[model samples]
Target chain A: MTNRNNAVNNAQKSWLYRPENHKKLWWGFGLILAATVVVQLFVSVHGHFGFDGWFGFSAAFGFLSCALMVVFAKLLGYLLKRPDNYYDDDA
Target chain B: MLELIFPPAFILILGAFLIGPIRAPLRPLIVLGAPLLTLYTIWQMGDGIQLTAQFLNYEIQLIESSPLRRLFATIFAIMAFVGGLFAFRQAKWWELAAAQAYAAGAIGVSFAGDLITMFLFWELMAIFSTVVVWCGGTEGARKAGIRYAIMHLVGGVLLKIGIEGVMVHTGSIEIQPIPLTNIDGWLILIGVLINAAAPPLSAWLADAYPESSPSGSVFLSAFTTKTAVLALILLFPGQQILIWIGLYMIFYGIIYALLENDMRRILAYSIVNQVGFMVCGIGIGTEMAINGASAHAFAHIIYKALLLMSAGSVLYMTGRRKCSELGGLYHSMPLTALCGIIGALAISAFPFTSGFISKSMISQSAADQHLMMVWLLLLAASAGVFLHAGIKFPWFVFFQKDSGLRPKDPPWNMRAAMVLLAAACILLGIFPEWLYRLLPYPVDYVPYTASHLVTQLQLLLFSGLAFFALLPLMRRTLTISLDFDWVYRRLILSLMNRLICLLSCLNTALRNASNRVFSIIWTYIGRHHGPEGMLARTWPTGSVVTWVVVLLTVFLLFSIY
Candidate 1:
């Protein structure tokens, strides 16, 4: 009787913890990423003018800006430390 | 088409009236359908067809068909459509009505040709968005909403004054470029900055946005700040002061976001941060920078909504939003988790996301202008975006230590909303040409090159390294960060509390002293005027009449003198 109950509990838990279908989401994301790379490669190879070059410039600057932001955050975090609940209900 | 000018806004107003007394079962459909109809009307208006309406003495253009205006209005319509879709499942009809009206106001501002039209939509957005915030069904939402309304109202008043000043001084209301040196222009700029979530008053964004409903935040994220960006672009594109103000907002967002625990609030600060970049770009005002600001706004609305939707889904499923209470949610809420991570990557400007394609234009513009310091500061802000919002939000919410709760994924409507937005994020990132063509500037920018890609990779990777290396300092806690709003909510409140205490103490002493003095006088009078005393002797009506006659004669003599 105990063994039978254990089996039933395990079955119920399996039903409860069913995983989300990641296959569709990741596949869609992978295809889009690949397509973006292909377009970028084609544009660079063809030496597309105006907006194409500016797009390249944009990518470079965005990355650089993001990097600088992270470092600045670390530095700022040092000076602005407070107790975990400094602004909690009482505070 | 000419007859249907401003149809979207009018439809929203009509829907709001109709739904004011509707029952629950029919409410959701009415709330959801209005925005869809409005969006269809907006689409039919298309490009380069300006429509004008005369209201009072001013001519208001209901439609300004410039590419920039169309780009913003189109996305706003899309936002309303998706926002309506998201709210259909859970929100009250009233909230939906308010959100639609708010979205209409934003879209209206986008297409507004002159300051008068813009100001009207601006105030409408303030009033309606505050109503949406109040519809969060919490007491906290009420106080926060009031503060939100006051800030925007004050901003509107300022803007109205500026517009009036411009009309009086210039004798024109053309809505074209005016030099920043003029008082009217500067006042207008100040008014627009308040909406852009600029510093000093920037606290209102962080204070109010997270307190709104889950889906409401999604709509809230797209409109007010973006409209301000449009206003700034129109009014003061090349003003140098905006560069510094934008930089301040960038850093302010990063720091406050780092300090914030509420998932949506972090996104709120990052909104300011992201807009800061666009503001900086607008300030730079080169062809490239303008393109950058406009493109970034375009891309931003998608990924930011994607982020909020993911967060909203988590909150919906688990009834938890603080990062402290969220963890290992990815195991059960994997779809939401995946979408969230994609949004994070996109916001951090990962190699192929929309943010990468869009945000870099401003930095490139700054470099082209040889504004090296501003260029460097913007680059740092980008990295901070990764640390504070892009990586940290997902890390805390999905992958941290298990909180031992196994909530199911959200309902189907929510799943559909997230999927739709995630797809938009990737699509915009992938096919640059589609969105690039919509910019005010011609499509002349490409987002990737060998050297640029390698350097960006290195910078961001190293920043990621910094995040991990300093993970101890970045631990999540259930705490609110102090911002400019703290001056009012905390400092001002405490000061007011003390003032009240002091006022009460002074009142008590004054009351006691007056009572004691009056009692002493009464005792002296009572002792003197005891029944047998001379003071108590009633000389009767004769004495009273004589006294009155003497006083009157004295008064008459003084007057004659």
Candidate 2:
């Protein structure tokens, strides 16, 4: 049983699953996020609404909206949340 | 001689009937071929009303050929072909048949030239889709299916009432832009919005869809809601209230999806979010916005189906659905992972993807109209889309943690369905003109602009950063967030139980009071009539003799006076 378990464990794993690469992945993602904002400086993004032309607006808006949404969901969860099987008895 | 113009929907409807009776080996021909045949017929028809029929007295258009109608019908047929391919091997025969009939309903609504025709097929979809939900063959599915049917049936009744009112007062059933000037118009809008999974009623989509079997969901994701969007485009384009309604739906989807644990439920909620963009486009009511809504619907079906198919794949191979229980499948199901990612990016509107091309037109229309607040909300919603659907779905389901599942990719047919849709998504993104050409209006918008791409990427990528940074808060619990359907599913039923109990108590009290009052009256009457009473008593004789003697004495005194 141990041999069979080990066989299952030893199957091919992507570098993404390795522990050492975790920080690198985060760093890379962070870099890409920064680049998307910085590159907008070189090319002016004309906004129909005046404020949208401000630097890093999309990035800031995107991040803030998501964060706010998560917080709102957490707050709402106190009242609205139920166990996954809440409806099972209705059958 | 029977002269008939065979609508494309009839082809699929006929195929639905054949699915059950045909042998297993031959079922594939009907399953796959019918949609292609329907597609061929849809494309072959010229631009005009091809058929008409008498509904009561007024003649109604049965088959109207327009760019918008053809476009909606075309994608529905494609979805049928691809969804059938995904389901043929795994789904029960009846489930497959119901899905085909459901697709027929969508296609029928597409070519419907009037409200009467549209309403008939609208109910058709509701009934058949409920059957597909029940085909999940679980107790949960059965209950969910009932809730689903009730919601759709209510929506259907609302639509019928509106249609009948319009037919009576306006004396027209033509599917045209309805000014929300009267009660009928509002009723029609509410009805279509319900089917679109618009807020409040929107919960039905997420609640019922996830309980369906894996492939059952793949079909469920496609038809009912998109047809509602098509109906909105046909019926109530440019109504200003839709903007707020659409915005509400978009945010509602994002919040609920964020709180969801089930993977398919997440996708199902995202469907509402995506359709919100289309509805908002229709509200914008410009040529550009109409084209955007139509094109987005076309692109949405492919990528959304692709996303569901991948999620379905995982569920099929592992029999596990909760994101908390899933991870590390990428090692064995690399193809599924890849296709799912493609679908995710496409939905997020990354550059060179289908979503980028289609979703931009709506935002651009808002910009053109200079609705600054609407534009800003649309931008935020776009980012939230990436956070909830684009990154969160693939991230948690495929790579969040090692839950130690290593199921291989689904069978070839399912894999093939995903690959085909993924390719279609990218191809549409790269050469959007292929879709833009099919739009009802002339195409003037370009999706590959430098400013748009950079901003979109910034928005999406930053949302990705937020997802990982707030990953702790985003942890999936074994819980579900409540929505409007809670009224029916929990609130209303419990209220009814209380009402019944209260009513019965009132009934018992009423009966007891009536009996006491009746008995008291009976006792009073009996006492008055009894032999010992003043009216018929033995003691009265003595009193009578004494009174007679007194009267005699009084009479003698009076005579003497």
RMSD of each: 9.0, 3.9
Chain A TM-scores, one per candidate? Answer: 0.41, 0.81
For candidate 2, write residues B104-126 as lDDT tens digits: 99999999999999999999899
Best by DockQ: 2
Cα-based lDDT at residue B155, candidate 2: 93
For candidate 2 chain B, which ten residues in a row score worst on lDDT?
B529-538
DockQ of every candidate? 0.12, 0.75
The sequence of per-residue lDDT tens digits that candidate 1 reaches over residues B1-561 is 354566466777777776768877877666777777776777667665377778878777766767888788878888887877877778777788888889879988887777788888899899999998898778778878898999999999889999999988987766677787677887888889999999889988887888888888998999999999998888888888889999999889888888777888889999999999999999999888998999999889999999999998888788888989988788889899999998998888877888988987887888788787887777777778887888889988987666777987788888888888888888888887788888998866678776456445544654565665567776776556556676876788899999999999999999999999999998888888967667897778988999999999999999999
List where candidate 1 sits over 4 angstroms from the true fold. Answer: A1-91, B1-7, B18-33, B46-49, B500-561
Whole-model Cα lDDT of every candidate shown, in order: 0.80, 0.91
Off by over 4 Å in 2: A1-14, B1-5, B511-561
All candidates: TM-score: 0.81, 0.92
Clashing pairs in 2: none
> Which candidate should be chosen as best, given lDDT against the real structure?
2
